[model samples]
Target: MRGDVMGCSSQSTITNFSPQIAEAYAILRGIRFAMDAGLLPAEVEPDAKTIVYLIIADAPPLAEVGIVISDIIHICKHYNIWVLFTPRCANMVAHNLAKVMPAEDLFYLEEYPPYVESFVLDDKAM
Candidate 1:
């Protein structure tokens, strides 16, 4: 399963849980909701071959995330979704955007500040 870090804006998507894994799952749910609403790439159809782009950060308890990741893997496996791990640097675009916005106004791209594009485009792997 994919795993990654998000900026503070994604904090809302996380459930108010003490464990990192639980918090991380909340973000995953938010992402799934966005996909349902057509925010992410349409190529990742749920019924067809699905792909999850998990953004990961370098931090402690990577092993814990690995355990939680197994759960994600199981669910994705049931749905035929492919999980991809992306570095935090690559995911910084979303994280940076999340940092400056009001919670109510976080997810919309049209409302994002101009600087976020630099982070988004900076990922050479793309």
Candidate 2:
């Protein structure tokens, strides 16, 4: 979530990687986007627990994916950023957005999409 706001969402396509690697790549991309948008003190919630732990530990894993994780850690050092892990159920709005958005199409919205409004409200209430 971006501060106390919960409706914002962004998605991008990653090529030539496993699902786990792609997830890491997406988180990296999201962090970069937030930095570019001047969203300082950013808070990131990735559904992938392993990747979150890897980033938080600042310990690069073996292989090419470690390079991406290392870059994420490097960029995060410049800003006040916290990477946390949230269960998929708690990230339904984003899950839904990813499903509906076409592959290779990067979708971003400041407010919750109409289709996911209920989920957003439900999350807020909880």
- Identify the candidate with maximal lDDT: 2
Clash counts for all predictions: 4, 0
TM-score of every candidate:
0.45, 0.82
RMSD of each: 9.1, 2.6
Identify the runs in model 2 with alpha carbons over 4 angstroms from their true place: 1-9, 12-14, 103-109
Best by TM-score: 2
Question: Which pairs in model 2 have colliding backbones?
Answer: none
List, residue by residue over 1-126, the lDDT tens digit for candidate 1. 122122223334434544556535644555464454544431121211112323222222445545555555554545544444444565666556545534653444223356665664564345
Task: Score each candidate by Cα lDDT.
Answer: 0.43, 0.74
Query: Candidate 2: how many backbone clashes?
Result: 0
For 1-126, candidate 2 gives per-residue lDDT tens digits of 422342355564546788777878888877877777667778888788888899989898887879889988988887888889988888677667656755554434366557877767766766
